[model samples]
Target: MHHQEIMSESIETTLALVDAEIVCFKFVVCGTVFH
Candidate 1:
């Protein structure tokens, strides 16, 4: 249904944002440790 599609899209967006945030945080930590 249309509602299911919308829900999946929203979930996918949220997960992508979360993954990006985690990667950024990890890079920051590594930079600080190495620098």
Candidate 2:
């Protein structure tokens, strides 16, 4: 994939993980971290 695609994928994965963490009550700071 191209460089932009790779970066996009990484951002998506990070957001997914942050969402999961928020859902699981693993952390309450994903908002600032992910954004």
Candidate 3:
């Protein structure tokens, strides 16, 4: 049970990181296009 919990937490952290990166990428793309 503890291992499963740890796995889930790690997954959530990774997903959050990915989401942040995607948002940052989109923002940069939009900025370049608009400018």
Q: Please give the lDDT score at residue 31 for candidate 3.
A: 100
Per-residue CA lDDT of model 3 for 1-35, tens digit only, reads: 99999999999999999999999999999999999
Q: What's each prediction's TM-score?
A: 0.88, 0.67, 0.94
Candidate 1 TM-score, C-alpha based: 0.88
lDDT of 2 by residue, 1-35 (tens): 69999999999999999989778774546755777
Model 3 error, position 15 (Å): 0.5
For model 1, the local distance difference test gives 1.00
Clashes of 2: 0
Off by over 4 Å in 1: none
TM-score-superior candidate, 2 or 3: 3
lDDT of 2: 0.83
- Please tell me which model should have the higher lDDT, number 2 or number 3: 3
| Residue pair clashes in candidate 3 | none
